[model samples]
Target: MSQKPSKSTAPEAENAAATRGTRLFLGLSCFLAGAAMMIIEICAYRLLAPFFGNSVYTWTALIGVILIAFSAGGYLGGHLADRKMALDLLGWLLSGSAVLTFFIPALHTVFAAGLSAQGLIAGPVIISLLLFAVPGILLGAVSPAAVRFYSLTLKDTHVGAAAGTISMLGSLGSFVGTFLSGFFLLSTFGVRSIFFGTAALLLVLAVAAFLLAKNTLRQQAPVILSGLFAFFMSWMTAPKPKPGVIFEHESFYHHIEVSERTDGDVTRRVLQLDSTMEGGMDAKTGDLILPYQQYWKLALLREPAKVGSALFIGAGAFGMPENVSREFPEAAVDVVEIDPQVIEVGRKFFKLDEHPRVKAHAGDARRYLLQSGGKKWDMIFGDAYNGIRQIPPHLATQEFYQQIADHLEPKGVFIMNIIAAITGPKAELTSGMLATVRKVFPHVEVFAVGYRRDETQNVILMASREDLKPLIQDRYVQQGSWQESLIKTHVPKGTVPHASYVFTDDHNPVDAIIARGLLE
Candidate 1:
């Protein structure tokens, strides 16, 4: 042992060391590839949200398609690895994934915009497949390839153990990536930047893989050039807003934008979340331009004496809050909006800061109500929605209405703004919400803001523990106003047909119900 080793022994020792190095490299590659797959899957939700909406259907399509693609890729990869465990192929797969991942931002805009014209059902599925399938397949293949390569470095008896270790490592990497992308990366960086960072990471992994395989520079040149070219194309094709977009922001919750358009002498500024116009106002007079806002006055009319303290569940542009504060100057208005960015946009562009008595709190409305230390209110308004068409499922459930009831005074009124047609198939949401509210309140009345029965309109549901008939008459006789006239003219006479189904936390089919409503 003290003497120099023989030439044959020296070569064996060098080979053993090189084999260990190759094993370590392959393990790392598998881990990184697993992480990249999850990152892309999670980010896909945000990328498609602005166009297809962050709905249950969209998520179902995305997760289902990606899983199917992964299954196929894993089978194909194992087959290829059995025939020949080549390092160059692994390098090519990673390089190709990086290039495709780089193009995601640009591809999302083009595909989503084009497919959306086909309708919600077809659009979301087609867009998800087109954007995520190839990258998911490529990433899925890496794990199988790595398993085969690692087994080659080990004894035949230990192959099973090596395969298990590789799988566990890949799973661990996926777990880490999920938390990091959701908790850190999404919060700190923009969507486009997240994609860019992912692409860069994969590029590094590709280069390392090629080097570990001892490939020549000529062999790696094509991969490097393709990545560079893809990056350049993506940068050049990035999305830009159309004319008249004043402000645009992407929050953890929503894709928000403010745009002003002039029609004749009136300049209307609108707040849009996702694809729907949440709120709008006349720029000149600061008056609420949306027709549904006029119906919020029904809450005041229903409880004139108890209008001192009011709570607004959803503060879109603070239009309803502003209107309420102006109408009842002595009232203390508390607005609980879930998104802080929306609150900021409200104060900056929607004149929310002008009201001295109005205060905005950023949190979920139901959670805030439950934890507000027994603070009771005269009027509780629920305008919480995902878009104009979809009410957040939690806000539409029976337990939520009970919370609303508990937060209100003994004679207080709760007004909710809902979108539904008066009759036909579109009435399910209205019917279900009415049934849920009636479970908590003694008196519930429905008032349609617009007179049209055929079109989808904003239907206001006024609920209270006491009889609202006397209060409505009292307010009408006192004011003798146009609001009273509008209320009398538009309020539907008959009861809702599908009032049998009540939405609960465990069984809320709001999305499916809304989809059926739209289809009919």
Candidate 2:
């Protein structure tokens, strides 16, 4: 109590406290900035899915463009740090990034529609760059700037150690962000809400950063104004359904939309997943309007006892399964649709819950089949499609067909509805699928549902261990209607040449094939 500390020592202690505060602030800033960057990247996929489709090509474009943006950001950030490593500058960067990010949802549909018209490869790349490149650059700059601040704040600490620690924290934050956003955010919060939440977090980070730097209100005015402008603009410009769209939802698997259109005398309700027409039904009669639905009727011609139980891999609009339940009251029908939301939509809009004989199971078709154990089906229908009428890669593989064969009864028929052209580059998908299915089933035949040679059409592939001609001939005689005429007109009489590539669990180029087909 007798002696007083020296002025120099007291000042040194104060400096130490101030440095510690700066380090803490910068560390938290870097961590959060990194987290925000990754969250936006993951959300970008969902945002783009409605237009570009969530495919390998879309992801490739996103990842590649984001990496390039990061590299440029890091380079520029390092250069700026060497010249003027100020917290206020970092604050501006974060604030600007937050503003741009907030605008993403508002601009998505507009940009997507405009760019997608260019084709898939160029479309996603250009759109990703337009939507995310600026923010990625701004966020990437945060890391190097953070390193500079840490080095300056902790003069006693080794520069290399400080840099390593800061970078590691950023990476750790990224890891957490990736898992949290993918697992929790997408499921818990809607896509637009997630973007809004991300922007809010960034805004908070920017404010804290600017306050720590002791910035004046006047100096912070522009950032505040920009953020406000972005928020209001985004709120005003958020996407809305087109005039006739009665309902729309962002499911974990797809951007589903239901719309109504009126013809001369009848109205039709259509179910669209992303950009592909999944199914349609007559509004008044509830009759399936898609031609593929009519073809599924052939399953009735399989073994009489075999037709007692059947499975449908995809349940779009529940059209075929509901029809089966209604037409064959004795038959037990099980439908597996991967998206639960789609099932909900089906029940709410398509009357999926009204059928007692049809049981809806929500899960991957392949996984459901594998887990079914000894449960066999008389007829298995595979109508699962992804993107713009492309079969899911896993469901189109040789191993998956083997699973189908195992789950089928002795004379069970496997009817698959796939979209591809009959004769052109697009026919590769048809040939490849046929080749894969042939590996497991002894007899296979192709029927062009639309009978279009130049345009992409729904090509039905029917395979069975037993000959199907007898069933077709029998049904032809019984029905003696359009079903007979369709078979004769659209069904291919000769075998198709084997495609250059076979789809397998290990190697599947279905996305690339579809992209080329769509581009052409």
Best by lDDT: 2
Top-scoring candidate (TM-score): 2
lDDT of each: 0.81, 0.82
lDDT of 2 by residue, 356-413 (tens): 7889999999889878999998888988886353467898899999999999888788
What is the TM-score of candidate 2? 0.94
TM-score list, all predictions: 0.93, 0.94
Candidate 2 residue pairs that clash: none
| Cα lDDT for residue 338, candidate 2 | 94
| Candidate 1 wrongly placed segments (more than 4 Å) | 8-13, 117-119, 263-266, 283-285, 303-306, 471-480
RMSD of each: 2.4, 2.2
lDDT of 1 at 366: 78
Clashes of each: 0, 0
- Model 2, which residues run further than 4 Å from truth? 8-13, 262-267, 283-285, 303-306, 387-389, 473-482, 495-497
